[model samples]
Target: MNISNNVSSITAHQTLLNTSANNIANVNTDGFIPKDTRITDNAGSVRTNTREADNNGSKRSQTDLAKEIPNEIIAQDATAVNVNVIKTQDEMLGTLLDIKT
Candidate 1:
């Protein structure tokens, strides 16, 4: 397994989680345009880009709980999967070295 890809995936998911958290945190703020975050991959490197939402005219923030909650859950699960992959790879390496010895 490629550690860099796994790490990049983890970083992307972490960014997703952070974006969701930020949106949730500003749910009650007036005129707070929640940031929309998107994860993209380039040359096997993952990254997150966030942009402010538009079309919100009311004083109340346009943050949606229904969407943010699921986004956070998905990001958390993805991050966990990437971490598990790294852990499993490490274990396999250890086992290989053990057999070598």
Candidate 2:
């Protein structure tokens, strides 16, 4: 398994979670435009980018709390899973080394 790729995926998810949190936090502020997370696949790895959203005059903050909250929760869960996988890999490597010794 490519640990580097897994780490990068976690980072990408983290960026998404942060962006969602920021959007939810500023949901009530006037003239606040929600930020969106964009993911691009670079070869086999992933890259995350955040951008400000365009707004219309009729909109308040351009944030939907209902959607943002669920997205943030999912990102957080995905990050946790990646972390667990890394931990499990490390344990397996350690076991192999122990056997070799």
lDDT of each: 0.89, 0.86
Native-referenced Cα lDDT, model 2: 0.86
Q: How close is candidate 2 to the true structure, as a TM-score?
A: 0.88
Clashing pairs in 2: none
lDDT of 2 at 27: 87
How would you encode candidate 2's per-residue C-alpha lDDT over 39-90 as one tens digit per residue? 7789989899888776666456778788799888889888889899999999
**Cα-based RMSD of the predictions, in order?**
1.3, 1.5
Query: What would the per-residue lDDT of candidate 1 be over residues 1-101, giving only the tens digit for each residue?
Result: 57999898898888889899999999999888888889888888888888887756888889999989999999989888989999999999999999999
Q: Positional deviation of 100 in candidate 1, in angstroms?
A: 2.1
Candidate with top lDDT is: 1
Report the backbone clash tally of model 2: 0
